[model samples]
Target: MDVVQQRFAEWVYKLGITLTERQAEQFETYFRLLVEWNEKMNLTGITEREPVYEKHFYDSLTIAEAVDFNKTSSIADIGSGAGFPSLPLKIAFPHLKVTIVDALAKRIRFLDEVIAALGLDNVTALHGRAEEVARDAIHRDHYDVVTARAVARLSVLNEFCLPFTKSGGVFIAMKGTDVEEELRDSGYSAHVLKGEAREVLKLKLPLEQSERHLVIIDKKGSTPKAYPRKAGTPLKSPLVDPAASQ
Candidate 1:
């Protein structure tokens, strides 16, 4: 095993998870593809080898804890730039039906190439904005789980993710330590997404002192059709708080 693969394996094992050889190879291939493609595209800034392992690979793998793979079959990574948790999670759980959505055609092109190179059968990369795709009957309310990483403010992120989540599905946002403040600021936009903050899981990464928060929101009911409200409106006119309404 190469140094990178060995280190990744140790990290996953320490996280109370195990990866088969096939899974590890998938990650290795993904890392190679990311690095190769990044040379030409602005896929990610963390190009150094170690940083790629920690920030890209490990950071993406952290979502495994928040998600129940047994119950989850379909997942959509909204705004999945360079295929973070979606591709990694799919590697870990090969049965997962994963779709990565990115608005930028370039990023989607990169993702498609990576998917093809990896021979990943269960994943699809879609090129379109989340707001537009989430409204389509095929995408709207179809996923078992939706994930986003540093996509937007909690309020805006909710709008982008929730529309694609099934009523019982969950949207897991990989966030930094400021999740509490973001959630507080989200307010009515949270309600508009038909979701509520379910729980926050604090995580520790190897050699990283900074904290990370996985904000899990459960989609409790149907989001009102009027929601997401065009491109710029959710951030501008969030729903009225029910408590404030009272």
Candidate 2:
């Protein structure tokens, strides 16, 4: 095994994920494709071997700290730029049923290429706005977990993600550590969208040691029909707990 795979295995191993030799090869293949395709179009700014392994690949797996993929079966990733957290999670678990939604068709194309090249199964890439896609019955309230990474604020992200989370399931917002203000601001969005806020979980990236966070919100019930507003409303006018101004 090469140094990248060796170090990646050691890191995720601490998270209770043991990588088979094939899994290691799959990650190597994924890394090559990421750099190759990125040259053609905008996929990710971080494309170097070690940083991709550390920030993109390993950073994605840190969700394992907040979630038990062994117990979870399905996940939906919203505005999944470069498929952080989901693609890596799929590579690690292999059993996960992953649905990735992105508004940009080009990114969807990249994800499809990666899935096909990696020989991954049970993964679907859809091209559409998150708001409209979440309205589909098959996607609505149907995932074991829903995730968004650096997509939007907690308030705006709730509208983008919570609609896809199954009742009793969880929506995990992957973010940088400065989320305290966002958590306070997102309370109304959660309440309006039928999610109960959970404490933000934190973990640091290896080597870089920069703190990352997972903002967890448990789905209390089905998304109210009025929710999510329209395609762009959630971004333009996110719900805020009016009482917070008091």
Candidate 3:
């Protein structure tokens, strides 16, 4: 393995994740594909080799620190723009079954190309808003774990992601440091969506030292059919703690 690849493997190795030579090659191929397609579309601003490895690739793999992939069967990534945690997790744990949901068709095409180039299996890239797609029985409450990056606030994420989480499953939200206020604001939504706040796993990027938090919310029951409201509703009208307004 080259220096960049070796460093990445070592970082995850500390997390108890073992990467074989093939997986390392797949990650390298993914990096090349990401930089290549990024020229045509606005895939990601963080395209440099090492930075991509630290921020996107390693950051995605950190989910393993919170939940064990060996025990988890399926994961649905909601609003997986450019396929963050799900794609990398699938690469590391070949046994995982991954479903990536994103609203943009162009990004979906890019993800499809990456999956093909990587020669990955059991991965599906769907183009649609998370709200509508989670309503489908095939996807709704079907995954063992649901993931979303800091794409939206906690309350909004709860609405968009909880529907895709099966009962007794967990929705893991990857967020930055400003989580205290978000947790306070998200109480009602979590309760309403049949989700309970669990724990947050804190860690830092190997090189950058930027703090990242994994907000783990346990799904107690199936999402109410009324949840997710509409494709654009959650973001515009995020649920807030009633007491805060009072």
Candidate 4:
């Protein structure tokens, strides 16, 4: 095994996660492809091998520790730039049906090519905006888990993710240290979307000592249809202070 692959394997082992030999090979292939494609497409800025293993691979695996995978059969990764958590999670748990949605066609193309190259049968890449895709009957309220990694603001991200999550499902947002403040700002929209902050899982990765928060928002009921307004409306006019509006 290469240095990157070996370190990744050790990290997973230390975290009490096991990947079959085949799965490890798949991840190795993905790592190589990401490094190569990034040279041309600027898919990611973290080019160092060790950083890729920890930030991209291990960071993605943190999702497995936070949620019950058996309860979650279907998931959508919104604005999946470079397929951070989705691709890595799919490789880790192949049974989970995963879809990666990105507005940029180039990123979508990269995801598709990587999936095909890895012979990953459990993932799909869609090139479109989240709001447009979520509005469709086939996609609306379909996924058990809707995830976003470093996407929009908390309020805007909630609008983008909540509409697609099934009742009783959860929207897991992978965020940085500002999670508490974002939650405070997004309280009204949380109520509007029938979501409540369920839990926050703090991550610890190798080499870097930064806070990664898994903000879990449970979809208790159906979101109001008016939600996820046009492309920029959520950011511009979010549901701030639900009681005042009522």
Candidate 5:
């Protein structure tokens, strides 16, 4: 193995994650494709071998710390820019059924290509506004777990993600920092959306030592139909405060 692979393997091993030879190969292939496609369009700014291995690949797998993948079968990643946690998690746990939703067609195309190249089964990429997608009968309240990786604020993110999680499922929002303020701002929105803050997990990235927070929200009840609003409404006017009318 090369330096990047060696570091990734070590990191995973240190974290008590088992990395089989095949899974390592898949990650290597994914890194190669990410760099190759990034040259064509804006796939990611962090394309260097080490950073990709550390920040993108390893960072994505950090979600496993919040929940046991063995118990979680289905996952939906909203605004899956560069397919962070979802794709990496899917690669690590081959049994997962992953659905990635993104607004940009180009990103979806990249995800599709990556899925096909990796020969990954039970993974689907959807191109559309997350708000509209979540409102659809097929997607609404259907996933075992829904995730958004630093997509937006907790309030906006709750609308984007909570609508898709099945009752009793969880929405895991990946954030960089300021998790406390986000949770305070998002509590009302979560309540409005029929979700409750379940847990908040903090961990530092192995190499960079950057702070990461996984805000886990349980979908205790059905989301109000008004949610997600329209395509761009949630971002423009999120439910930051329950009293504020949208």
Candidate 6:
């Protein structure tokens, strides 16, 4: 194994994830594609071998720090810029059926190429706004785990993600250091949407040791019909904690 593979393998091993040779090769191909397509359009800023390995590959797999893909099957990644945790998790755990939703057509095209190149089965990349897609009978409330990584604040993310999460499933918001403040603002929104903040998983990245928090919310009941109002409404006017703001 090379230096990059060695580092990634060691880090995932600690999380009870073992990478196969083919899986490692797929990840390498993914990196190559990311770099290649990145030249044409913006995919990611961190494109170096080590940073991509640590920030994108390893950081994506950090969802394992919260819930094991070994047990979960269906996963939806919202606003997956270059297919983070979901794609990496799919590589590590081939059993997962992944659905990635992103707004940009270019990103969807890139993701489609990546899926075809890697020969990854049971994975799909959809091009549309999260709010609109969540209303589709085919996708609405149908995931075992729905995830958004650094997509938006918890309040907005709750609206974007919780609508597509099946009742009793989980929506994991992967955040940075501003988790406490985000959580405080999100409690009311979560309840309004019939979700409950279940747990917060705090961990650090391997080399840089950057702070990461996975806010796990359980879908206790179906989201209200009014949620995710429109394509841009969530971002324009995010749900707020009436008490906190007052």
TM-score for every candidate vs. truth?
0.93, 0.98, 0.98, 0.94, 0.96, 0.97
- Model 1: lDDT of residue 80: 93
- Per-residue alpha-carbon lDDT of model 5 for 73-181, expressed as tens digits? 9999999989988999998889999999999999999999999999899999999988999989989999998999978988899999999999999999999985998
Q: Provide the clash count, candidate 5.
A: 0
- CA displacement after TM-score superposition, residue 132 of candidate 5 (Å): 0.6
- lDDT (10s digit) by residue, model 2, range 1-246: 888789989999998899999889888888998899899899889888998999998999988988889999999999997888899999999999999999998888899999998999999999999999988999999999999999988999999999999999999999997898998889889999999888788889998999999888999999999977889998888898777667
Consecutive 10-residue window with the lowest summed lDDT within model 4? 237-246
Question: Which runs in model 1 stand beyond 4 Å of their true positions?
Answer: 235-246
C-alpha RMSD of each candidate structure in angstroms:
2.2, 1.0, 0.9, 1.9, 1.7, 1.1
lDDT of each: 0.83, 0.91, 0.92, 0.85, 0.89, 0.91
Structure candidate 4, residue pairs in collision: none
Candidate 1, residue 202: CA error in Å? 1.0
Per-residue CA lDDT of model 4 for 93-184, tens digit only, reads: 77889988899999988999899998888788999988788888877888898999998778888899998898988999999775787888
Deviating ranges (above 4 Å) for candidate 2 = none
True-vs-predicted CA distance for residue 96, candidate 3, Å: 0.8
Q: Number of clashes in every candidate structure?
A: 0, 0, 0, 0, 0, 0
lDDT of 3 by residue, 93-212 (tens): 998999999999999999999999999999999999998998899998889999999689998999999999999999999998859989988989999999999998889999999999
Instruction: Output the lDDT of residue 85, model 5.
Output: 87
Candidate 1: C-alpha RMSD to true structure equals 2.2
Error of 6 at 36 (Å): 0.5
Off by over 4 Å in 6: 243-246
Model 5 lDDT on a 0 to 1 scale: 0.89
lDDT of 6 by residue, 52-137 (tens): 99988988888887886778989999999999878988999999999999999999999999999999999999999999999998
Tell how far residue 74 is off in model 3, in angstroms: 0.3
